[model samples]
Target: MGTYDYIVVGAGSAGAVVAGRLSEDPGTTVLLVEAGGKGRDLNVKIPAAFAKQFKTGLDWEYYTEPEPHLDGRRIYHPRGKMLGGCSAQNAMIYIRGNRADYDAWAAGGATGWGYDDLLPLFKRAERNSRGGDALHGGEGPLFIEDPRSPHEVSERLVDAMVEIGLPRNPDFNGPTQEGAGLYQLTQRRGQRWTTSDGYLRPARKRANLTVLTGALVTRVVLEGDRAVGVELEQGGSRVVHRAGREVVLSAGAFGTPHLLMLSGIGPADHLREHGVGVVVDNPNVGAHLMDHPMYLLNAETTAARTLAEAESPRELVAYLTRRRGLLTSNVGEAGGFFHTTDGLAGPDMQFLAGPAYFWDHGFATHDKPAIAVGCSLVGPRSRGRVRLAGSDPSTKPSVRFDYFAEPADMTAMVTAVERARELLATSAMRGLVGSELHPGAAHTTRAELEAQIRAGVEHTYHPSCTARIGSESDGVVDPTLRVHGVQGLRVADASVFPTITRGNTHAPSVVVGEKAADLLRSGVVAGGRAGQVA
Candidate 1:
């Protein structure tokens, strides 16, 4: 048994930041617990080899229950199980989402969560190689860089988007997000740089900070109306670890809700049926799940130099010796945001272009080279839920995305696919690409395209909002991120997003972690002195 000023579960995307930044006060004792090992694997370090880690030991390997809207097919969700969590496993696209995303959250009852309130934190966490400005950060923990060796397909994809009438904006994390350009990566030089590499490891030497790996938390320990500790299994024993001030649950979208239910802070009737005592009876604990549904349009590239050559011995030698090669590619090398429908605050769809065959999560390979253009529905109106499978902690939760459950979502996706076809037909890709491999040339009509979508649609790996922020009537956590009916507890992760952001969620998750630390430091969320980091 152990005790600390704060116990941050999961050591993931946000939890690592919470534990690391909390211990910055020297006076505070912090404990970070993780179920996985260190995130220094070879596959994790190589950007192009990211998909190799899927369904492996480093992944949580979660699969949703058959989604009714997608022809009752189970969608695979691969969450990083190591120190950095999804941030370590993601494509590392350095996008903070459209400014309107935060404004909408603030407008929807999440006060102080507007875009302006978060921009500085986003800046403070990034160290862009291009240097800082009024909009970007120059000196920060995480490193952002340009792709070291983007293939010909990547450059042509950007050109094709522009040739099809999109602006050529160089920076997606700038004043605007509507443009075709190369994506900056969460990388330094050429290797993948995760939050664990940037934030957690640097703070490990602090005497006040403790990191426990291979620890599986059973549940949060509540005393009366407040969370005081947690029960976990480490090594061969079950143990209890107490917190002096707070127990912050950063176990991510799926794990956080699962832990809350296991701790009896979920729906009263549901807990009762599972033979557990209810502490909060909050029916909103695991509701309102969200994710971006994406369909990849693959075409055989007549031109050479795609990810098909990224794994060759020559490229590896270049990567290992000089850190410059195709291995630095994040796969989603170049793309942009665009509105398929008008009257929206920002672009509703995001294009993720990559120079690879990229199907079945990279398990499917082709004899010839190919280029993949992923049309992702970023502003999905569809919602889903997460439910407990059983009382056991080892049991995974049952999640249902219900993708395309909203007709507007399907309409937007189909339009995006049409746009993709238009981009492929452009002069920029005239002789470069030919013969669509997915949604084949045979499927042309809207109805047939929708069917093709249901048959092969995947996600951008951005799962969030299962434990969203709002009042007690509609949400599990409040504006300050503390659970509504529970005391001395808070959530700082993608799970707390009132609405999922308009782009890759890694950057926003980093901001949430930074803000969470600031809140704890100023004693605002602890309720001693309410103040903003600004």
Candidate 2:
């Protein structure tokens, strides 16, 4: 295969930005490889139809190896496999996590990754419909807009949270995050806008950029301690593509670690068992996994026409003709960050409420029109692990989030349930809501609520930190995102987050790409940028 200045694996959220930004220099050549096809499905464009892509070709459709804490249930983990990755598959919520998250990373030995350091990158990647501010960007690729049509019940949900003792905040991304408001979305005119749209699409026309779809990277081709290129199985043949400067792995939390271990960059004993040569004996390759375990509280709604009728003829007509209707709803429509207890640096929980019966990844539905309020344990102390099931790159890795493994994790979730119940009973929700559908009247006590949470909990789909940024003693990637024992290689996705962000991971992943581009460019020391590759 041909050689390029940079080879970016997995054209997902961060990968798309990495490839697009690197190719900005016309003198540089970049190749972006994606395992899935271009994400152009009609459902991908419709914000409300995001759940329709789950388990489809666009989804990786992964399942965990049975969590021991949650009655041994094998929780489903759906990841985007196509161009924009989860950005094309997510609810389009445009949230950058708490400022404390980045500051913690710098404190934890991830130098130069502080909130002040990355704020510019976040602003640089944005094009808010509300225009520029001290905190937002007005002229960038990513488009963030208010909901085209907000359902009355969704608005009431925000009011309900405020009535239940939270402050009313018009802008969650403004000075503070501890308040209730309708969320802005990553959309333009009611259509989903992904990093693929913001970054990749415009850059694809560049002569120096080459994008290959349906290409699954098997492993890194290492020349001693340096990653020279990547071996990918595209079509029916396995080919090697050389990276003249560097090989950046934006293959996500799971895929990046999987590819690293397959390339003999993991624990020496584990590699020996798989009959593979060991180049680096790092044990932190697939450890320290963390995710926000979420629970949805649904209630029958006699006051609002929920998303059950979103596909009806009238709604369809409105969406088709004007792009303004229930079809434009991003299901978790109105929400805000909150704390389960006081004096925390930031909120430990988030409320994502909407006028819909969202459950079991939207596969399970209710007979009556209803509203759903989802609470995620954003600040969990629990960690998990990801290990290869076999030596084969085609096999999915074995994962277990070990959710609720820490007693505090369960306590916070229970507190979240109590708060959700408070929101449901508030005067703002009195006429709009009915009987509780999940963890109903029977589960009221602390223990009962804990049981209900264990039985009914889901997640916010924010999995991260498997290849976290740390010293060689604790993590796979260093502060600069370079692998500990490898040269000319780096990991630039949620995998490199020192700790999971307290909110959606999409926007931060894009920032990771922007920061990676700067770091790669800054590597020009004594020679030309490409010629300086180790």
How high is the CA lDDT of each candidate model? 0.89, 0.90
Please give the lDDT score for candidate 1. 0.89
lDDT of 1 by residue, 135-166 (tens): 99999889999888877788889999999888
1-534, model 2: which lDDT tens digit per residue? 889989999888899999999999999999899999999998999899999999999999989988999999999999999999999999988888888999999998988899899989989999999999889998999999999999999889999999988899888778787899999999999989999999998998899999999999999999888788999998889999999889999999899888999999887898788877899999998899999999999989996568999999998999899998999999999997899988788999999999999889999978999889999988889999888888988999888899999999999999989999999999888888888899897888999999988898989998899999988899888777788888888899999998998888888999999999888877742223433544
Error of 2 at 487 (Å): 0.6
Q: Which ranges of candidate 1 are over 4 A from the true structure? A: 526-534
Count clashing residue pairs in model 1. 0
RMSD of each: 2.2, 1.5
What TM-score do all the candidates reach, one by one? 0.98, 0.98
Q: Per-residue lDDT for 362 in model 2?
A: 96
